[model samples]
Target: MNQSQQPDAADPKRRDILRWTVGLSAGLVLAPLAGCDGGSDDSFSATVDTLPEAPRIVAKNGLIDIDLEAAYAHNSVQLAASAQNAYPGESTQQATDLRSYNGAMLAPTLQLNAGDTLRVLLHNKLPGNDTKYSSLPYLNYQNSTNLHFHGLHVNPGIIRPGVYGDYVVDTPDAGVVPGASRQHEIHLPADHTNGVYWYHPHLHGSTTTQVANGMFGAILVNTPRNDFDLPDDVRDRVIFVHRLNLSDGGRSDNLYDYVNNKNSAFMLNGVYQPTIVMRPGEIQNWHFLNSDVFYPFNPVLDEHTLWQYARDGNSFDRVFRPVNAATSVQMDGRHWPGNVLYPGNRSSVLVQASQTPGTYYLRAAKAPSSTGEEIVARIVVEGRPVEAALPSPHRLPLYNAHQPITDAELAQHGGKTRAVILAMLNKDSDLLVQPIPAGEEWFIPPGDGVSLTDTVFATGNVGTKLAPFQSDLAVTQTIALNAVEEWTLYNLNGYPHPFHIHVNDCYVVKVNGEDIEPYWADTIPLAPNGTSDQPTSITFRSRFTDFTGKFVWHCHALDHEDLGMMELVEVRT
Candidate 1:
């Protein structure tokens, strides 16, 4: 064979030790608190290390049986560098006690195949919570928690039958409260749509506080690897992004803060400004997950291209740049498209290190101009050249829902449309989620959907909005099984909300009635309404095929979800 005909290096899908750097992104609310926000381009001597990947529990013989425990890490946990960010969930002065899954700040990553039986015996060893933060009297029960399989299409049934696959309601199963343990068995079907998903506590009151304090991890199921036909030298990395804030004296940062393993102002795999060492022509598959309790992050690698592979755990038909994702952080003074990852969103991409590279950074350009830019990570491409080729991401044929919901599928559901108003009937910062399930009388008197004499709750309207879970209420939104439906998500409030749904991924059809490329995702940003008469809206179609029972759709800004911007829906067979 000629020089051009030589085969590429093997794809081992493993990581080798390489030195790197990471920095914390200073958000507007966090800028003042992150005085010691880890190393930057200057602190090479602080600590150069391999990205900290949480230990993986891979399935063996089609079964992954593991004992997972949750407890408080009392002592300070940090990297070897003194310059690292101090991640004390309570105080900026010292590393305080924080909750963790299996004693890990980032929790264990579960690797499984499509037909794997994931049996986990979760032991909740944490202490009881007695603090209340908001209007809801039950908002501070931090000890009461349950695991929700973020994107897995599993049954949310009773815990006695098999396990609590994705069930989060407080009725039958009261969740794994303090000192209690529960075994969860989730069996992925032989054709489960596979890629990267996540697991986190979903108990109503403490969901945001716990997740922000580092109770989340990744789940890689049936990665479409052999379909790529690559060798064994390729590197597969999980880049889980999170925020760890500190409270100084009486001035506390947002309650949305979570204590990740790393104490950086902003973190990637529990470290500040983590660097990924690579050689020219080397390819790496990265699972980019945004686990921040609130806010979306738009990441731009200085010179690299994030070849889109999948979104929300479903693979695309082919490789393509995601809509609005910037190819690179352009130095030109022009505004570029956004590759935004809202809270609870994940993007899997393939990046090839340029042949002659120096130092590149994974940076973000947020809004409000002044506090918009921060470096997420550093990528140093200088080493022995590895001859490698990136295959097409579209080649992977996932199970069902790999493609867009077709027009034929929508026709079966009969022109049925449901609406939800994203408003703030309370404080400005608070998010109000008013679920307007179909069949409700549309009384057009300003609040429009349903007419109420006094409280909307008096007429089973949920009192205008759900507050702090209100766990013992009737679910007005009931979805029919084996049907595809379009949903109108309206952002009536002036700010944006990352709308997310469980058990199914939806294809974005339009924004404010304007048709756009149908992008499939479990989470998508509903643009701000800006107090306009015509609120910002997103229309999406989703198919609820296999698995039925209770699940939720909520604002992915987790704090907002904790407050009330979440709705429970039962899919009846």
Candidate 2:
């Protein structure tokens, strides 16, 4: 029951139903109806049948088993910089054991047809690192991890539930936590969409550690049965983007320090040392995913339009949809056409063949700004047309416009909220001369300038030790906000820290609580530590209902969190 499958060209009635399904009822009507057919050759299908045939890779519908074995040493292999693996000369670091993979970790590009069953066997070899000592949400440290089939319409609770220590909504003995040597089955609905989906560890606390060890992969779905309606000229390629932050030692035996302080330096798949190269005049569709901590990878297209095909493996039929959180987006309305892939997420982008064949560079954009980084891949579109390329259904949906928040919405909430500052605690420096008495909430007075950075509150004691419940602000320990209070986060650090809260999908109420031109995110990217502002900030609103847990609010950067950058958030409902 693949949701992205189109109606049969021979059956007009089913075709109309599918059109309506892909348009208005993406989740409900389209999903269930597609599932009822049970991968049958019936009218209710989840693929397009009118296009050319897809190149065969694995079986149309089968399982791809991946295992993580512990390695005490390092492995070396030559990586391919070209599509056909012609120039495999560079020797790079490899995962010594099942527990790790590093220095350009590779995963097979999964290609499946609609109604295909994706059964995966994820084995965890390095045990006993669950939650007690690990920083990530522990599914089961003894043999914990998750297999979240990102963007697929399936039950997450049941798929690849690794061993459970914490961060699991489903308890063990319920089949959510896998015992040692046990394998879990993830069932994808027949009507699931044909876009770029992905798999990774979803164990709450331990996600950082597991993913850092190269425990992530990409999932690509072909149209109904992988044999239907695929264009000849363009072939789908799955590119898994990962950040390798390994220590000086070998990869396999190295401990996964979720709190690694260094920023990500390597891009595993297409942007690694040996960049991906493609033939000219041959259209290539790229499916990308960023398995980094929380940094957003924005790729650039200079000569090409970078036509988007899908997000999160699901096809977007209509011109508009709402993106309220960090999720997958399929640009093409179908599986054949590719789309744009965002950082910390997945996307399908199609690079059409160029009339003039030459080397074209694809670069990665830095987070929280428009600036891009080094080339990720090079397209030498010189070869003849491979096959009949399927036309990407590039309908500029209005929903895409609403994505990443708009300027007007940011302006409306700007200046309507109060500013809050983020700074580290050290003994001695108190420009405000405000002492943090024990057992009280802290509060720093907003300076007279439009931005918080302009206002100086604390200074000098970079060597001071912060007593418990003692902060630079006057309020001390508790951060109390009156009902309906709008707050703006004025990040004083120089490095990027993604700010996140529990329960509520926060709108970018304002940029620095004032109208400004900048990107908006649920996780505000703070400046790097030790750098002076150029202050960055964001505002958000909350109703404060039904979510009265001892939740946490902090920078999504795992290193920052371990260094006491996180705080307890108790929203009084």
Clashes of each: 24, 89
Tens-digit lDDT string for candidate 1 (199-280) = 9888865787678767888887864242354455665677788766543221112242332223334568766666667667
Q: Could you tell me how far off, in angstroms, the CA of residue 255 lies in candidate 1 after the best superposition?
A: 4.5
For model 2, how does the per-residue alpha-carbon lDDT over 38-73 read when each residue is reduced to its tens digit?
Answer: 155332223221111111123222333333332222
| Error in Å for residue 398 of model 2 | 6.8
TM-score of 2: 0.52
lDDT accuracy of residue 342 in candidate 1: 74
lDDT (C-alpha, whole model) for all candidates: 0.61, 0.40
The per-residue C-alpha lDDT of model 2 at residue 550 equals 40
The alpha-carbon RMSD values of the candidates against the true structure, listed in the order shown, are 10.0, 13.1
Error of 2 at 297 (Å): 3.8
lDDT of 1: 0.61
TM per prediction = 0.78, 0.52
